[model samples]
Target: MSSSMSVNPLWLFKVFPFLRWWPMVNGTATRADLLAGLTGAIIVLPQGVAFATIAGLPPEYGLYTAMVPAIIAALFGSSWHLVSGPTTAISIVVFGALSPFAEPGSAHYITLALTLTLLTGLFQFTMGIARLGTVVNFISHTVVIGFTAGAAILIASSQIKNFFGLSLPRGATFAQTMWAFFQQFDHINLHVMSVGLVTLLTGILVKRYTPRIPYMIAAMLVGSIYALILNQSLGDAVTGIRLLGALPSHLPPLSLPELDPHALSQIAPSALAVAMLGLTEAVSIARAVAVRAEQRIDGNQEFVGQGLSNMVGSFFSAYASSGSFNRSGLNYEAGARTPLAAVFASLFLGIILLLVAPLAAYLPIASMAAILFLVAYGLIDFHHIFAIIKASKRETAVLLVTFFSTLLVELEFAIYLGVLLSLIFYLMRTSRPNVISVVPDPRASHRPLVHAPDLPYCPQVQMLRIDGSLFFGAVNHVEQRLLELEQEHPQQKIIIINGRSINFLDIAGGEALVQEAKRRRRQGGDLYLYGIKPAVMEILQRGGFLEEIGPDHVFETRDEVIRHVFSVLDRDICMGCQQRIFHECKALPSPGGKPS
Candidate 1:
């Protein structure tokens, strides 16, 4: 190959990320991926339909989402094992956002969902282009756990009517749902209840005993069989059992989302919420699986992949989708070798959809509800919830607040509230940096500074260490502490700050230090700093604060700062004092005006 042809442009990899891993595709890798893809395809059949029910979309739309979006996300994203499809959380959020505006599963609602997906995709794509992937870190893990648990409960509550064959209104709140169920206790349909219970119990048992089998498919089959027998022995009208109806068996057809200005404006807020939540879920899952697979994950790339998936999927009769934790985990465990596995999975899902779409007519609504109940149960991370409660009261509070907000408020607003509370808690913690007095340990060979309150301090000098960044938010608290120290020890006018722990120094912090230096100078004392980082020193210098504080006032070594401060101390006070905390104190003149 010529030099021009041999040298591939770096931008190509950005546009086509799969090229990076394409070289790993050999016979062995392809075979492994095919097997993994087959496994994933089998698992997604029931899950796709279930997630669609949660999203208030038709069953086939879930399979459509699992098809086009899965392929697109796998081809563009950074993870090799992460399978992007309809997820429990995203589905719930979609339903919650659109149910109030239009009837669930209606044409208008589907259009609204498609539009929302497009807007969310645009937002995600913009963020990826801006390289704002790190922004997801602000949504704490506790917040996600809490929000997911709350959404799970909502999912289960939404299905209560189908599970018990009650005539409850759709989109009822948790409290309202419970109240309605209680009022209709006497009219419960035992036939539907029996099918749901059988499904739920079968799922739990299969998952516990036959770990290799897909529990959802197993449970669904058992429930369907039981329902069929009941309807055969009795009659459909007599038993009052309802079926999910047949699904369309074809490729995802092209569709256009409504682009009216009013529709766009109405859906903007919910779109933003879904965008953030979806990105967080996708990136977090990718990183998690990457850890086990020993692969590197690029968050920005993952964002781009998800953005493209949803944007393209919007045109394919698919609703919003995100990373599926169960599917991704299963993909990895089934020995997926490359992103091709996800692509294959999507292809296989399409093929399976074509073959089995009519069979959905045999599936009972009660059985589907039973599967959803299991899905909701699995969404709660009980271990992490308990760990958060036991490890930190602050985290526990965040978890509880997020949990309650998700239950009490609108779903989108609940996400915002949880994020806002997390940011507030973070600011509160960082605003008050730890300012503690420290002294050198005499017994140590190098006399390293230690936080020992009981150790005697030099009567002429006070030393303090700050254990956080010096930002604008922290300046006031540090300044007040400095003033308090000065008031408490009037004789200790020469204050030395151990600045090793201060990693960042903002302009306001620099100004505060300058003002403190001037104040000390006016009082016949001085301020000194040692072990400051180079970056912080650069800030001090660029702002001219270092010049105001005097370049000589800063030192790189503790011994130099101590020696310089001691040389300028009031010798008269040292002569009368007996606290010889510093080695230089032995050189001070005695009361008779002679060298000791």
Candidate 2:
């Protein structure tokens, strides 16, 4: 790391982007980073093995992911405290994507997993180079909530057989899994169920009451102790408990993915899903950590860093990797002063694995299942789920659709479906930009504007405000609404638009405004605008729309426009009005054109 940092700043920034934090490193920062790194290493030990199980990879591969990718992402990525590695979400996604292509845990499966990693890295790097980090924005928060909830169910279901010692078929659908559990209830293995129950109960208690201790480690310890006692009392043959076995102790070895055309074609769709999901997870974690660290993250740079990490990681036996939310948050809370903390964590993890590999032989499979159940449960954001359900009907629809699709459809496509539905709803809302009718607050001292549906408006003019952007996609809606306004009240030729809320305008919107002005002029009246933002004004001026609408027709405030427009209405018509809504109308003669 020091050797790499000794180069030119510009060159280092290009090659090792995290070197920017190099200058800030000193005795104090190094001590802090080492402490944070040690804390992270301790937390990831059990999590790595669990995540690898989720991905159907060898347990050691999870550690490899934590090591190589963590180091590379820290050195080349944007965020100071974001720790990249194997995550539950990414692991499950990898499993769901590639399980159809090859047998999970087989040599062929490992090869295909490497290939997918390479492709995902390539796609991510290209997107970064293209500066397309904003693509994640289209995937709404509701989509994430729905997909996670769905995935949580999938995770829990996948572990049910292991947790309960049931003989369910592998890779069964959610319904089949549940059905199998119920059918096998009478044949349940009490020993296995007891171990899982103890593990789950221990994890829940430790997490709730003593969060400082790594819950996975604490739970695994208790479950392993219980299993040892059971095995001692009743022989292993009678207990029928299984172990994770000793994990690989050596460093990650060199490997190559099968690059044949058939392999690429087989994995293409899955690779795309992995790439997009990895990016979304990584970027979201980075941004979330950045807020607490009071730092900024470069999404494109983070993309490139994650890409390079996975691309490089594939050759070193690491599967797809992304930012780990738990580890990153722990890094921040553990006093990480720089990205070096993540680097130190990778180094410490490698060292710890060498010492801890043999101890895994005593770890029971039921314990792992129990830990996963907890992880899956944690993924479901119940607070946000209830909030969405209570606050918005449309968002709730997105959440339900995404949640169900995740359970019913392919995991990858479920994400896409949620995003598609979200976009559809968004377009539907934006295309029909809210055209609100506003009136002066008669009860207010300064005549502020408010939406009062029952208020009596002047018969000759209508006051309206568009509360969204007027781009090509929305022009037709705005135009149609304006047309409807004219049709509804033919005598109200003047339309005063309160443009304060309109932040965007395109050529189509400009043309629509010009057409409205022209239509009003044809009827011996004209359109008036008030409180136009500078950006909208620029669009109007640049498109030669201000001339069409006439500069005198625009006003800086609603009150100014209303005052001037009141003077222009036919005096004879005003004389006959029974309801005098505006203060200007009070000065008019009673039932005649003469002044009062």
TM-score per candidate, in order? 0.96, 0.90
Q: Which of the numbered candidates is closest to the native, going by highest TM-score?
A: 1
lDDT of each: 0.92, 0.88
Positional deviation of residue 147's Cα in model 2 after best superposition, in angstroms = 1.4
* Error in Å for residue 444 of model 1: 1.6
Q: Which ten residues in a row have the lowest lDDT in candidate 2?
A: 587-596
Expressed as tens digits, the lDDT of each residue in 1-596 for candidate 2 is: 69866767786686778668888999999999999999999999998998998998988888988998889889888899989999877788888888887788999999988998998899899898899999888888888888888888888899888888778988778888898889888988889989999999999999999988899999999999999899889978988888889998888889898799988987877787788888888899899989987888898998899999999999989999999988999999999999999999988998998898999999989999999999999999999999999999999999999899889878888888888998999898888888877777777887667789787777787788899999999998888888887788788888899999898999999999998889788889888999999999999998999998889999998778989999898777787876577778778776655665
Q: Please, what are the lDDT tens digits per residue for candidate 1 over residues 1-596?
A: 88877856578888899999999999999999999999999999999999999999998888999999999999999899999999998998999899988999999999999999999888998898898989899999998999999999999999999999999978888889989999999999999999999999999999999989899999999999999999999999999999999899898999999999999998899999999999999999999999999999888998999999999999998888888889999999999999889999999998999999999999999999999999999999999999999999989988998888888788999999889989998998898899888888888887778889788788879999999999999999999888888888898878899999999999999999999999888988889999999999999999999999999999998989999988888877889766677878778776667776
Instruction: Give the root-mean-square deviation of each candidate in angstroms.
Output: 2.0, 3.8
Which parts of model 2 are misplaced by more than 4 Å?
A: 1-15, 440-446, 453-456, 530-568, 574-596
The residue ranges of model 1 lying beyond 4 angstroms of the native Cα positions read: 1-9, 576-579, 586-596
- Clash count of each predicted structure: 0, 0
Residue 366 C-alpha lDDT in model 2 = 92
Among the numbered candidates, top lDDT falls to: 1
